[model samples]
Target: MTPTDLPVLTIDGDRVDDLESFTREFSTFLDDHTWRGNLDAFNDILRGGFGTPEGGFVLRWVNSDRSRQTLGWDATIRWYEENLKVCHPDNRADVRARLDRARKHEGTTLFDWLVDIIRIHGPGGRESEDRVHLDLR
Candidate 1:
């Protein structure tokens, strides 16, 4: 995707605070390893939260599959797992369920939500359209 097509989000401070707190707690859920698929824990860390901060959140996905397939996938997955501090689910339902929960949660922080955005859009291995001015509010 071109720079013009990149997506941007408004992540405010209040939202950032909630996400930071969640990240800290979520970090406790992971093992000190190089790689692991932990998406559920990550979702749990942000579900049912709210964003009070003033800034926006931006979501970007860089596809290195052609250049580094394993590395890209591993890095993306690891980032998601580590950020959310949760394990990946076996089916789409489980993943969706977790996201539903997090969205339901009140007062989601910015940092945490940013992680969520990344996780949701991380798959497919192809460059995506730049999504800007998405209404997160």
Candidate 2:
């Protein structure tokens, strides 16, 4: 299935009032042209939980500028390992596990991480466009 075809998991938040707005913006951000090309790869990363589950989120780009020029999952994984260093400082174990799974191309570690984050932070929790390191904690 395609990235667009994948379902978006709902997450809870501190203020239920912000949920609607967050969902709208989050959907827009993911739907942006720059993101569409690599939506699958981003989904792959999201499925792995490189981003935080609460407060903010992240997207891995093959290029530093985050332009969706590449068309491969390996590039997404490489982007995470080479450039993006997400995960809370205390969550190093989680990060390392994700790294290892990504390296081995395992699905559980990656998708569970993604589901957990989305469940914890909801959509608005994703990182801001200008943020380099998304710290949800």
Candidate 3:
């Protein structure tokens, strides 16, 4: 189907500064947007069937410039720290490594991570059939 035929589901970056607010923005589309509050859950949600359409759709993130700044390093560091606190014992080392890298600003920021996750369901990604395009504005 043409891109125009698909629905446009928007998330205001102005409403998303971290994972908490990030998931909360979904209330605009879902009756209960309360979520697992993690990257894995975010990825799963993009797969559709919750409240989002099962077919192709556009996830337009408006005010994305502001979101990039808000969901950047600071949010990444905080997420990693939280993961370290609750992640499986065997995963502690990896979480620590990521936290260290985040502290050093040596890897992808949280914003990049979110974009990557959403894009993975788009045209050429691993789950391309889902056709969940991310329109970052």
Candidate 4:
């Protein structure tokens, strides 16, 4: 099938400052029109059947540069902090180390995490069978 035939979901990056904001926007892709999932949940959504067509969809991100900066190191640290609070005790140390890395500007930013998730569902990715495509405009 041609690219135009598949479903497409677009989120304006300029409007998202952090993971919460991104989730709020990403909820537009869910069947219930609301978000209650974490990063893993976001990945599941990409697998389709959750409002997204099982056949797959195109994810369009506009003004992504601004988003990359906004969700950079500081956002990464915040993400880890939130997880640290409710994470399983055994995982706390790992989360703490990640947070420390973010503080040192040494690990993935929220934007990177998001793009990685999306790409995983794209061409040549592990789930490339889904036919999900990334449109970073």
Candidate 5:
């Protein structure tokens, strides 16, 4: 199925009451699809969302910039750290390396990476204009 044919996971930044609530909602959404609440699971889902028949999905973020400040930076970093702790030792190094790279990338936040990844892998490949739709307004 095409990326547009898949379901869209909408995150309303304005409605995020707190981190706990956002976490709970996000986790619940992931759980509904049998996601394991880890980077691997997240990556798998992304892969599936991008034309993989097994995983088809889309993501829409409203007020994404605000969400970045409210639930993007620290929360995503903490998630990476927490998931890394539970990951296999062999994989930890690679995960850490990626995390380090992500940190070093100027002006590129986790959310930005996520959106880019989706665009690169989805439908029209890297040049696909239908990237993760973010409503900054």
Candidate 6:
């Protein structure tokens, strides 16, 4: 299936505090599938949840910086690994390239990359709501 065919799951990062809550909320948000205590199941859910697996899906985490800190670096890495495993083989290379870009650029931190994964995989493109903007008052 084409990238545009993939579903988009937009997460409000402000609400995710820990893995448990994140998982709970995520599952609730999808409202069709449940985690089966395995990365593979998690992967399946990531691909489409109750939706079609062939098309996969995009997970956009808003306020990613805060979410990254909340999830921690190790968790983030684990997430990346799991995400890669679930990605279609044909798309893996492109995903890896995105990861590399995030690693190489000082401005595009790991947190940024985590969020970008969603945009790269789907037709949502980029939106202001996807990012966390800080305003000094």
lDDT of each: 0.34, 0.37, 0.84, 0.85, 0.55, 0.51
TM-score of 4: 0.92
Ranking by TM-score: 4, 3, 5, 6, 2, 1
In model 2, which regions exceed 4 Å deviation? 1-72, 82-84, 108-137
Looking at candidate 6, what is the lDDT of residue 6? 42
Model 6, span 1-137: residue lDDT tens: 22344455566778877555666656764555665434345544444436433344445566766777776654545555666889899989976775555455323433444344434334444432322222111
Show where candidate 4 strays beyond 4 Å.
none
Q: lDDT per residue, candidate 5, 33-133, as tens digits? A: 65433444555555544342344445566776676676565655665677699889999997787667656643455556555555664556653434332
Candidate with the greatest lDDT versus the true structure = 4
- After the best TM-score superposition of candidate 1, give how far the Cα of residue 64 lies from its true spot, in angstroms: 4.3
Ranking by lDDT: 4, 3, 5, 6, 2, 1
lDDT by residue for model 1 (10-108), tens: 233232223333344334333462112244544332222223112212332222122133223333343434545454445556545544554554333
Clashes in model 4: which pairs?
none
| Residue 80 shift from truth in candidate 2, angstroms | 3.3
TM-score of candidate 5 to 2 decimals = 0.50
Q: Model 1 — TM-score against the truth?
A: 0.21
Superposing every Cα of model 5 onto the true structure, what RMSD results?
5.9
Model 6 misplacement above 4 A: 1-6, 29-31, 52-54, 73-137
Q: Tell me the lDDT of candidate 2.
A: 0.37
Can you write out model 2's per-residue Cα lDDT over 31-130, one digit (the tens) per residue? Answer: 3323222334544434433432332334321121221112124543664564336546786776676667667766443223433443343344453232
Report the lDDT of model 6 for residue 99. Answer: 55
